[model samples]
Target: MPYPPDVERWRELVSAYFAPEDVNKALWVILHESGGNSNAIGDSGSSLGLFQLNINGLGAGLSEQTRFTPSENIRQAAIHVATTNNWTPWGEGALFRGEPFGSLGNKPYPGDKKNEFAEDTVAIPGQPAPPVINLEDIDEEGFELFSPSGENFEGQFDGYTSNLEFAEKRILNLVLEHNLSFDPNQGYGKTTTDELGDPVFTLHEEANMWSEVFFRSEQGLERISALRDSGLTTAGRKSAEAFLDTSILENAAGQKNFDDFRSRIDALAAVENIPIQRATDIASM
Candidate 1:
């Protein structure tokens, strides 16, 4: 079934969070289970969300708010797939052969000594007797259940793997470009307030600012200290003040202001060779 429009949006959001290869594998499995239709929350009450998660009795791990949101749902679903795939059941099946029993020979003949090969039945030495090998004694090759003769199971498995790889790549690209956060421990769920708590700036942006202010500037520390001390009402100044007070940043409404202040300080330090001691002296004033 085609994904619901809302579900598609959710898929995009999820793709933004994972690697492209992961996205493909996750989406493929989700389609197989739920066809990407959020409404298909199964009659058995076992399936939920896009992946048809079996929430049944499982404690409410996924946030209720995220359970229904397409973006959040997909994100959680992707995480679910990753988690399940990592487990011995799913991971082994995908990584190794699905049927390990087939490696052993077929059943042995009945009444045969364990591990003993079957020999022709013997009657009196004078009379010839039909060979009476035990049915259980036959060591025939075990049945190939997953890949039955004339079946194209290999092709199907290959297709699934390919899809998984594609999804993973797409997801990875999205994450790199958007700075999406992930927590394997959290699995997939709505972005917690804490998860979204960082200043709403990309890592690259933060790194760049840090480099200019601390590395390039001769008096980088001093200038930064001065900026922190400056009673400026600018967004950057406010952010610095907040940073000084809390030592932690959040994605609240004032992040932009704080980020701007951070950038300005970095730029000033880069452009001016303000000595750290001098900046500190100014800050002391």
Candidate 2:
């Protein structure tokens, strides 16, 4: 596999799927690993493709065949980065993280290495990614968090922690309510959907809404962003990043991993005193 000839596409994806800092860092990581070549293979035969990811460490759902596609390679790399802080698995060190880039692997004490990434990092390989719910299967005519019909998922909103999935869904629904929402005109912001609607956002805007609503606090956002920046994803981080975590192009356990993350969110939200509904700004953005 050659580096994605269309580096910009991958850049946009990274920007869309990851927090602000992560977008640049992920690209920098590839800059070091494959020189951004999607087709680049590692000197070590086991590694292949853009990020030079080893098939062995790729975890569940992905296989050798995925190497040929630049999109999957970048996506998997971002996931791996989100799961674990630092680019160590990709053969880079915490050097670009303001530490020395070289000799990172030779640091000697593997266990002693402090991941030191912010708390928001999210990555759990044992569990599969959330199931990629087919947007086509969902009703587009109108949006509803609850309804007389069970198909509308009336129970998805179980408050801050348990309703993680619902939050993501609602963000999408609200964004789709073009008649009801407007854009963030804030001039600058993180995430890909910064400029969605005049009042409400769509696409990446939906994701930004999820990121904020789940965390429910500035500290929460930073901690989660730190986690994302460092490349680690815990249950809480996953909960916060769920919007970005579930990409349409990838296969997800969909609802499978949602519970674990929600549980984590439950515990943390209790401790943090985060409200079930953080704010309605996303809807009115």
Candidate 3:
């Protein structure tokens, strides 16, 4: 059966985190949990979002606003499923244990929305098992994956290290071009001073820290793009963009004005037609 538009979107999100075969199973759990509502709150508001994540327990450290976001909620749920290799966290999991990737269509949701365990056999009696497909082998064409795989799925920081390196090189050039004063006598850049008071400044470290500011702004743009693609509200996209624009000024190369920094880099990138994923990528390059 075809899912409703919103439900299909949630299924796509689940596919982003879980293996292709497991997507249906995960979505089945989602149907019972939140009914495909991204903003659904249950368990007296303690549990929030699509999977009805418990904020006090598994959903700890994430803000309420974040939990309400569909992408994040699905990602967290997928992480739990991957970690335990079982859907044990949610109440629905207890009902369908042992055979994690079994055909969910056969196991209809209990008439009531209540998550109750059934004394049914682990696998459908005498049924053939589902084929095991590795997550990495799946050709996810349209989906923009935030994480590479479910196994040890850390949040994606695709070009962070390279961005830092590029930023450091740029900063070194900037420091040299601008001739920013670093008093060797006072030991300015966190490295030891030579006998002649010539300081060996670890400018790379400074560049690393400074580069993070730009990287964050870049990451914010990526998230905003994802949000737009996901059909998030204009107000939400604007709010996120506004925050990113404002925050970049605080630590971006000691620049007081956000517009100056952003515009300058953007203008240059535009001229060259560089497909920049990170701000520092074009800026430093």
- Error (Å) of candidate 3 at residue 18 is 1.2
Candidate maximizing lDDT: 3
The TM-score that candidate 2 achieves is 0.35
**lDDT score for residue 183 of model 2:** 30
Two-way lDDT contest, 1 vs 2, winner: 2
Worst ten in a row by lDDT for model 2:
106-115
For model 2, residues 49-150, the per-residue Cα lDDT tens digits are: 556666666623555436534545665666666677556774566655423466422112112222221222123465443312233233352333211111
TM-score for candidate 1: 0.29
lDDT of 1 at 94: 47
**For model 1, where is the 10-residue window of minimal lDDT?**
141-150
Per residue, candidate 1 scores C-alpha lDDT tens digits across 10-33 of 444344434455555555444444
- Each model's lDDT: 0.35, 0.43, 0.48
Higher-ranked by TM-score: 1 or 3: 3
Q: Quick one: ranking by TM-score, best first?
A: 3, 2, 1
Q: Candidate 2 — number of clashing residue pairs?
A: 41
